[model samples]
Target: MLQRGGAHHRRPRAIERLVGAAKPTASIRALNFASNEMLFLQTCDIPSDITSTEALGWIGFDNTTAAEIFERYIARPDPTINPADLLQYVYGHISRLLTSNLRNLPRVQAMRVVGLNKPIRRALLDPCYDQILWTQDLHFWVKDTLKINYATLMQLQQQLGNYIHQRRSKQKQKPASVHGMSVVPPPAAELRHWQPEHTATVNMIPEDHNLPASHVTVSASPPTIREGHLMLYKGRAATESINQDGPIADDGSISMEVLSTCPGGDFNWTSPAQYWTPEKDVAEQFRRWAEQRCPYSETWLLAIQLSPEFARGLKREELWFSRDWKEYAWYCKKTKQPLSKFNHFWNDPPAGADLMEGHICTGVTTAISRMKVEEIQDRIDEDHVLQVGENETKAKQCVFLSAGAINRLGREMRGKLHIDIYAAIQSQEFSEGLEAIALK
Candidate 1:
């Protein structure tokens, strides 16, 4: 017992001797100060309540000293000190500094000092072993599987929230609104840049709702899947080939497995598909239902059915609803006239091909789809290719843009710009707007 007590007493004395003997070199001073700080912390058991400045001030340690201490902790000076214990001490000091009311913390300066002209390999052997200790509020820095003590992390989160609230309260007070005065303009009539035409709202009905009383005995022969037509299957975004001619059932229901449809294009195939008997003579009702669900354009359906309502409020708002490529191509094929009809520039012959031979563009054509040449190899037809007279060997979708409209699509799609539909009307002389004055 006496030997153990003597050893404990001699430990702090050895650290004091190291500190007294340490030269003015930054690394040596840092090593000595760290030893002293660690010994003090272990003896006092004040990791929770002690402030970073208080600990540093106890031995008059500077930012360089703090940085040196951090480096030694990370380097893991094995046999001399425990890496885990030292890491815990470092975490405590930095965390206290971060959550403290100090106007400026030396934590960043200390990090910068250590990182200056230092190669990463010199500090750490394995990148995975490189640990970052962050307070819970800075969740991006904190990993999903936390390495810190759960109780300590929770306490840090509370501290951070309290600090933030106090800072915000001191910075500014909430403004009070005047009676009968509009603080902001009303919402615009047209859809804003952020708003999408359609979104799934959560007015959920039972998944298994009873069929209408009048439609009790209802059935129909399964429709044949059309060729060269886009079929919007549930759970998939990219187009894939489906069985055009499959075996039919005697009961009028389809047998093929189809994934359930949802708001997003993603399909989950884990759940088994089920057959549902169609309501007899309800083509008009189905059309109305389809219109209500996807109002921008007409949607053709096959065997699959949509639920009565989406279970959750799913807000999937895209600039355009990506239908099956076939459906999109088919729609374009039907509604659009050929680009050649509008402009003679589109009818120009290939630069290398015989001018006397002319080009396929002179021939009557209707719609064109943006299909890559390699994608449609050997199957060169109107739907597969357009006579742009350019080399289509490049690994990109080929399109004949005769007009070459300004390409602002990339920047606009990034969501930086917003349409101010009300601003235009508000600026006109016919509009009257009010400005506010502060109350005495």
Candidate 2:
């Protein structure tokens, strides 16, 4: 984490802002619910080039100076670097870019990345790049950029959720926030000790740690500072103030009582393909949850949070030499099989796996769409995984679950499976499961 010794320092010297024209055009398609194409596709569906960092051989900036980005990003011979080591390397690389390069200063400032696997300390940091757009500004940005009036709908949904919470007794409802799960302030219950609460409350919080593990988009809501600011949230000062003369006119753009949602992290920046899994799949979880809860509601507005790390595992070798497109994980079948030439684009089975029709394709199996609930919930699936060197039974479950939701839900995910992920630190469920996440 970025060390803060004492008082806040003066804002760093202002540098020339990065022009949009200077940066390469982002190829990712914008979200459009009205368009049949947008609604039909999955959020995790990604182009190999966009998700693959190796796809960019070099970045030529608008700067007249001839220094290209990622020059030092040489391929390492060792592919077996552990997660911790890999994280450290990435951290060091980003740090070096911020300190050493002038062209990168703009992106570095906009990102406001404090440290590897750490929350951003926005309030303390100098407003060095205020002109640039940050993640939190997406609500307004989407309206202006896409020429779509989504901001109005989003605000309405927030109001609707708030109304629901207020009308329903605390005994019956969750204190819902339209913001990403992690962005909500940590409750008094979590700040103190163990206590029995509603199962919903228990299901709300992040993982066991006191700190929020999910990425949160801070909002305009006023924050109580005496509670202790961990430099996690985006203070109201940073948010774009919305001037509502009254509740916005009902455009009926979203016909149903808009039930808006937000997961954590920057899904716009990454694909959620990492969450696909054979077990505890987000698709299965959602299918079961929806089926059991509100089978009447044909449509659900789902918000899934995609971490920055989600789609970043693509290596140079994977893009060019190797065909393994799946995220490496303990339970993923692709990780267990030997690294052989398997075409992920095609339906060809990997070497050695029995080619039963719609059965085990080994490295690349799309059979997740037809996975039975028993098969997904079964603990026996965990036993089958090939544990090579590591004996650890757990890793980040949310990441795997996100990928699983997409893989299992596929095109149906956009319409049904809303994968809103928050940091374990941010999620009540991830933190204190069945605890006090629902508490106001």
Candidate 3:
């Protein structure tokens, strides 16, 4: 039975099935009706379960057809009708139908408003009309899907108008000065000449061994010299030790203090001369790390972390080595740690499970022959203990468990102990039972 409004409408079950299967055909028909007038009736005839009234209700005539239909509706004037009122009524009804359904909307409205002789078109499109006809069906569609009501739609239209008006106003208000003026600023005023009272001085001293007191002479004229300043010798050479060997300490070992200060006038130059070595050669370290970690069973999970960071560094060495590193490394920058460190293990499945089985499980398993299940299970148990210990020390931390591990534990309890795994785990009894078995 097909229900319409509150009544049961007699409709064949087979027809309903056929209609469901024919939805694509119906959509095509609807599209055709919008573009072609003759195809409209053919579409209307396709649905045998629908009455002519129902079909007509959905069939929206385009503007040309609506105007013609409206004229026909008005010509048979019963004495009670005023022509003006009748025309308005026909226009409103046709316009409402035209706007409501997607199948009939803009195309129909365009055909109708344009089809009305030129005078009618001018009146409908006039700014004086003020009210635009809109379909309740369209209003309902918008309200249901996007929560937009008639009042909101009107507000949006007003906002659009304001935006357009503001843009036009701005366009008209650009500065008139910008139109004719040259863009370049005038040249800066010429700089005034200024000179310092004291000119720069050059001072140099020749080594004692490089000159003889007898040969040196004082002169008022600029001295002829190369590379160093010449000093006027007015007196006998001062008694100074001219040590042939580079200056040395009394103990015969060269003193750092004397070497630095004596040579460069109290300057410490060791810091600038010091060599630097990195804490870790990231490329070499990553290469070795990748060689060791890449072939591991957990490589996929590791690659997820390593690949990105390796890429971010843009180093060929980092890229080559971390390529096989399973964990995503780039995530560490945003997360403040490598993916392996930040991501909860329990939130992800064991790395190799996907390859063996179609899906990853989140609990205990009975299947053990695939690999060293016992060894893996023991490692998982130890990890859980370490996690719990950490959690106890850090009260706010939450521990994550892998789905595969949890699934295996669940299967073990249910199969061996005959316990409901969900209830046991939820009640915290599963851990108690495991403790008992470990102690035994």
Per-model lDDT: 0.22, 0.22, 0.21
- For 1-440, candidate 1 gives per-residue lDDT tens digits of 00000001123332343333222111111111112221111111112212232222222234565456545555665736563643354445444333333213343343333222122112221222211111011211121111212222223222323323443354443321223322221122211111121111111011101111111111122323334321111111111112222112232222232212111111111111111112222222223222222111112222222222320111211111122232323223323332332222122222110101111111011122233323322333333221221353211111122111101211111111111001111112111221122221
> Order of candidates by lDDT, top first?
1, 2, 3
Top candidate on TM-score is 2
lDDT of 3 by residue, 180-224 (tens): 432211111210111112111111111111221122221222223
Measured against the true structure, the TM-scores of the candidates, in listed sequence, are 0.13, 0.19, 0.12
**TM-score sort, best first:** 2, 1, 3
Alpha-carbon runs more than 4 Å astray in model 3: 1-70, 81-84, 96-440
Instruction: Quote the lDDT for 29 in model 2.
Output: 19
| Model 2 per-residue lDDT tens digits across residues 118-146 | 11223112233221222123222212211
Winner on lDDT (2 vs 3): 2
